[model samples]
Target: MTASQPTPASAATLDAQDPLRHFRERFHLPPGPDGQPSVYLCGNSLGLLPKAARAAVEQEFAAWERLGVEGHFHEPSMWMHYHETLAAATARLVGARPLEVVVMNNLTTNLHLLLISFYRPTVTRYKVLMEGGAFPSDQYALESQVRLHGLAPEEAIVELVPRPGEHTLRTEDIEAKIRELGASLATIILGGVNYYTGQAFDMAAITKAGHAVGATVGFDLAHAAGNLELHLHDWDVDFACWCTYKYLNSGPGGTSGVYVHERFANRPDLPRLAGWWGHDPSERFQMKKGFRPMPGAAGWQLSNAQIFPMAIHRAALALVDEAGGMAALRRKSEQLTGYLEALLRGLNLPATMLEIITPADPAARGCQLSVLVHRNGRALFEHLAQQGIIADWREPNVIRLAPVPLYNSFQDVQRAGAAIENWVAQAE
Candidate 1:
């Protein structure tokens, strides 16, 4: 069907038939200006709170209250091994083996830890390649990492920018760049989904290209983990890290997830920053002088689990499992995003005023559709807020709207479209 053909009645019909529509009630949607639920299309920034999260957190509090320090070994849940509970579900979410995944520190911290082992640089093969506009945290981490190795950031870091006037990078161009960097490319790291443009890269192809050139391949899945159907193990990703607060619906500053390929599971030769918790549990209590790391991704843990955030994470992951995993979510995500695209395009706004910068091909993007506003951009964003359409506005020009399948309804998309249309009408 054409972008202009979907009407409000059609939207209702589609919502009614949606198998996942009932999942919307599982979240707590923020109220709009009218004191009703807002059209929340901003999961790309921060997801709505899962209704189950409160009970999960209370369970942890109750355990601590009853057992004190002994809660580390108590029933119902054990603080010492709490992170283990998340490993299997997280593995399934990202298509990795349970042994290869762990829930631990915040995103950038995990990235730095993974890079310590993966981004080993030699005098000749010292350059790192990444997408030009990576999220600021990734950029900062890379720059500081290179300096730690006593290499100049300018000489050791390479960023790939799109061709003239392009909003996103092409897969072929990325592959070409990898080949161009060749043996000098010590590591390849990019956001699995570009945060600004909402472009999802071909990770398997990218991993293959990086390995072909003797480079370690990793991804900052901060925007991709819960938003995309990932297969990190099949793709041979060396390492990856992501925050759980966005699409995963964990609370703000939720603990991050890490994946270290199983090949590194027992590679004690790999250099890493170790802590007491990461020590082999059998020997951990012995308080030995040497750090004998545990096998698998669990070995990357620097401290014991962050109980409060992890409680919420466990709760959020249950919702994903109950919804039949990412395969089911991805199917609905494509349709929900497509419906929003249709509604926006149907407005027929002048290109000078509004532009959908996100890739049109569903396979090349996530649920986010980045709208670039040329004139009165902030005004338009304010109009959206006033009209009860919650979206994310990037500095300068872009506004990002994500119709998350787990909670957002088709009616939310209709309201967003109407809000933008009203803004245009008033401006005219």
Candidate 2:
């Protein structure tokens, strides 16, 4: 059956029937200069603030004032066990066991830490395989890691790029490359979703292929953790990390999360750069000479949790759990994004003017749609901004629009589409 054309009335009907419609009220949308709520479609960059985040942080402040240092062991919320508060929800979001996940340092720091253990290199099998255009920080991290081990990145890092005339990598091509580099490949790490193209890779298949060749596999889930329905445990991913600022709805520069497969949780031989907080909690206060790592993902921690960021994390995660987890969010996301895509297609802009770089298949993408604006791209972006449409732009030409299922409404998508069509018409 042919899909109906997306219209304002149709969008309103969808919003009215949305089971998660009430969730829009849960976020504090950014306002324009006129004090009106702007059309926010950049959740893929930074999520809207949860209404409860301020209160949650203030609660921690009150506890700190009332108990001082004693807050570490006081009732209500103890600072000592703060990381534990968000573990279950975080685990649920990423599809992992509670023991496999932990909230800790920022994203790249955790990646370096994980690479220390998982990116084990030897004389014969030391090369790392990754996407060619991985987020710059990852490219830097992997290159520096190889150099840290006295290996030249040009010789040790194999980057996989899309085929000619392609915007994203093909899974079969990725697996084929893994097979080709079988013996020399020591590790495989990729973004769970490509930040620039918004393509969600086949992580499970990739992991299976990497394992077949004796390579440890991991993912940088900066865009996928909350946007995609991930199964890090089921996918048998060796290690993974993500920052909570984006789709996780934890504020800007929020606490990051790490996951280590259960298979390596108790491996005493696994080398890690640890600190006092990662020592066995029972003897953590003993000031012992030996550094016996704690079991599970917690063992990788280097310090105590950041309570303020975590308090915000707790509040944001509660909303995810309340909305019935990733399953419910994914359902709404598909429809809302599908509607937006249809609207963009209806614009019928010529290839020379604009093109959607993100994959057309819903299974291969999340909430983001990256539009490549060919003529006067930045000026067109500015035009949208002047219309109170808060979107993100990449250098060169890409305009990224993300319709967040948790807070963004169908009307917002409609407005964004109409605004884009109108802008293009005026520019011409």
Candidate 3:
């Protein structure tokens, strides 16, 4: 039941037999300046760079140097519609039709773009429903959008708080709030996965509940898009957005994607910021003053894609697809994260002193484990970092360790757990 019994070398033997073990070789993992590998458990913050990403990006750069203007149409990967090329793979990752997805700007920017279209609010129904402790960027975006609608954020937004002493939100409480908010609800935008806690919400059920009350439902899928199983189209989610830099392994500030259901396709009435890229391919060069929005999510594009970022994103996604997409990844994620949880529980650590804020159910979360450091959380995290265990630290007491199934092995999780226990012992 415990991981401590296994010799560290046994982990290498286990990794040798792992079906997805070869994936680690595809990434150029972080190394100390001295060229030693850093124990990277921070895929939720920034993913390790895929070797293919480097190669793919280099092809584009090489083309640019040799072909100049010809790179747009003659390049191996066309920049003229670069983001379009990525749509197919992204759609598969998020469970949407290819036409329903488009790779474009960064995460926060994409969220703001989606909000402009979906967050229509009338005086009677101007409330934005969200979890109380959403990522600061999400909270800021919602508040700014509310103010743009000519209402005070305090009056226009409704945040759902967990009851006293609870770390996670209850589904029943969320549904009750939707029922109670009733007519005042304009849009429901939520994190598809809670960032700090790594909790994956029930997208289908929430979408259904929101639609029942005439609210348009959307999600910011920063943590869930690739780390968890998603069917945004099947869930009937109106729209969703996520960055590729995290679980997608596309490196920092990599291209992000947005999903607009097929129902919204060709619906010219939907508000969107415009550019030549969103214009019809042939007509884009027509230089006609009138705008002609393309069909599906491509119409939401504001500018041509970033070729290097899109190339990197494509390379990373190929790794996910090669591993048999989310189906295989999710199955392994359950086991890997479950194994980590088991190791933590075996430490016999008191729940009062340390805690896992993430949901216990595999159905409700992804591969990341968000641990609350009971005492001297920041110092403990610093100590772990010094030990070459790279996890992300949030204010207060949270340290998020995501053992990405695509590249991380059970051995990595075991070492991370051991590091945490050792750090705790040192503190004592």
- Candidate 1 lDDT, 186-291, residue by residue in tens: 9999999999999999999999999999999999999998999999999999999999999999988889999999999998788999998899999888887998
Location of the lowest summed lDDT over 10 successive residues in candidate 2 = 1-10
For all candidates in order, the CA lDDT equals 0.93, 0.93, 0.86
lDDT of 1: 0.93
RMSD values, in order shown = 1.3, 1.3, 2.0
- Model 1 clashing-pair count: 0
Each candidate's number of clashing pairs is 0, 0, 0
Residue-by-residue lDDT tens digits, candidate 3, 350-370: 877788999999999989889
Candidate that beats the other on lDDT, 1 or 3, i.e. the better one: 1
Ranked by lDDT, top first: 1, 2, 3
- Over 108-208, each residue of candidate 2 has an lDDT whose tens digit, in order, gives 99999999999889999999999998899999999999999999999999999999988899999999999999999999999999999999999999999
Model 2, residue pairs in steric clash: none
